[model samples]
Target: MGIEWAEPGSSGHVLEASMRPVDSLQHSRATPVRARMWKFSLPLRHPETGRLFADIDHLGAGLQRRSIDRYMWLIHDRDEGSAPHVQGALRLSNSRTSTQLSSILGLPSTALRPLRDRSGQHGAFERYCRYLLHESPEAQADGKFHYPDSAVHANFRFRDMIDRYFGLADSGCVPTAESADQIRLKVYNGDMTPLEVHGRHPMIFIRNHKSIEELYYKGRHDRLIAAALAERAALKDEDARVPSTDPHAA
Candidate 1:
């Protein structure tokens, strides 16, 4: 499940009304109830400037790490005839705690602020939210973007190393064999590039990269090769102990 940032209801200024006895209109036996409506604007503006604010990337990251739901306002635009609109408007620049926003805006505990004006486009905030939750880390680390083609080549080499170390058909690991075969076929046929493979199988790619780094980073290939041989033998023994359900099983 994912986080739900918006709520359902009518949009724009939320009107809260209450009724109390009218003092002037009260008689001993007859009293009139006076209804009063308070229009509370959504605190979708900068507290100091009362202007629309948007710092999408920061807000996205902050939302993931922070628990200040009270501090954040739902971005909304009101249509006179429609239900309250809460969709893609950007949030305030400051990702402060709800208490802070409330204190700064002098807002009542029950009121919420929606963005008075939109930041030109809808869905941008949503996209940013997704990106922050998913791709922002890799993007920040210069993992995928920096290498461009290097990661693909690196992944290909890693797959080749694994296949060489533990022969696909001989190895007891069926899933690993299937994944390796897919990589081999794609790399050889030019149907998939290294980067594309990484995208499809990121966990495998990262694990392979780390494995390769352990093996070759300090020029310890012979030791790693010996370890792989021992692992392969162990797998072969494990495979032999299991009764073959299929006569064709390797």
Candidate 2:
């Protein structure tokens, strides 16, 4: 006898088999993302010296994203009306968790410090930073600053490595007149180069509201925010409904 195959739509058994795989898949779904926690040591400057430094044990969680640049002379001068006065600003620098920068650059951390105050169009720091990447290193030892282009985000990663051990010089309103003068000597007139700023306030990734907000898209952000609030309210309602276990009183 010749084998007779059922028409595609006529076979209930075939459809059931097809849905079995999907049904099995539904039971093994992944868990939703959980909030991340982090820690960071609170840093402060010496009231007198304005020297900045942080010990090893600081960590904070935030959705890791590149911070926006700010604190330019132009921004300070323009009156933006309602924009919040520049309460503060953050500067990013390249750093290396790898020894690649150190091995290639030869200059390492110590050499970079002396040139930290580069500004006024011809600062030693920028020159050295660019120079090392080009002149030294492995196969491209002669390339010099080859990575500074958009591909490497300049020396940001290398700069981040330097971020590990850094110092700070306070420039904004000071606690006293003497301290203010010290800042003037140590810090630029709110024009400190990005390197100096980075050492002062090392990049932090904190898992605060901003981190959560950023993870969602523009429209989704609002919806998620409202949903989270509602979920929290429902939890509170559930807590209120739980019966107390005071059997003796009853």
Candidate 3:
């Protein structure tokens, strides 16, 4: 069963879903979680800087500490030259209703949208991951896979965290059809090829020279490579001053 949305009213958006007990037997099955996933989007601003919220790491950690089972946050501008906003999905393991979850997140009820997957399809979490990362078949066919510079804050590590939480393993065995599908969903939306996606983890690929050049420097690969090399040399020089036995030595 999936979430059913209430009709719009003066009360704003209200999420309604049938609650299901945590099925222990499902753990042995291929499906991920029995819990439903809710997507949230809200504008957050830094009071001092007048920019987007910049402490997503702290926000994510706080949510996890509050017993949120799994979550992923993506910060991006709403439009060209517009202020950035935060959007993501979360899975609740407890009995808290959607209203309660919104309260805990300091967001109005309208911000939450319950995700529903088609019959015999991937779980809601996987669906949201593909949609947000622009890896879904629909997104690919439409050529709508693009994110702004603010998308640099997109947390790919959370995908790995969610996989681990669900006990999904990435064994280095030969790729099956299922494994190939998983790789497609996990590939970055940037200019990376399948070979590159297979070679590096998503987290590392996000911050590597190629991604930095394409995302931030507008594909100035040569300039970016030179800067990266210079920075590495400077870091080595700084490391030489540290004693080998020092715990802080790089």
- TM for every model, in the order presented, reads 0.19, 0.16, 0.43
Model 1 RMSD in angstroms: 21.3
Q: Which order, best to worst by TM-score? A: 3, 1, 2
lDDT of 1 by residue, 1-250 (tens): 0111122333323322223234213432443222111112233433334443333344434434223221222333333232332222224444433334334334432343333223664433333332222223354354422211121211123333333333322233323444545663555444555565456554444434443334333334455767899999999999989898998877
lDDT of 2: 0.27
Which stretches in model 1 have alpha-carbon errors above 4 Å?
1-13, 17-101, 112-250
Q: Looking at model 1, report the run of 10 residues with the lowest lDDT sum.
A: 146-155
Candidate 3: segments with Cα more than 4 A from true spot = 1-35, 44-62, 78-84, 140-156, 159-250
Q: Write the per-residue lDDT of candidate 3 for residues 1-250, one digit (tens) a residue.
A: 1222232212222232333224323423533323356776655553234544334554565465445766766764433433455677776666455566654666544456676666876566765654565533355466644453245333345444333322332333332232232444344333545456535443233223344334433434555777899999999999988669967856
Candidate 3 positional error at 200, Å: 14
Error of 3 at 96 (Å): 2.1
- For residues 1-250, write the lDDT of model 2, one tens digit per residue: 0111121112211122244565436523633221111111111222234433221121111112333121110011121222211111112244322122223222111111112333544323333433332312331433322332232222134333222221121222222222222322333323332344234332211101232223323435556778899999999999889987888856
Clashes of 3: 0
- 175, model 3: CA deviation in Å? 5.3
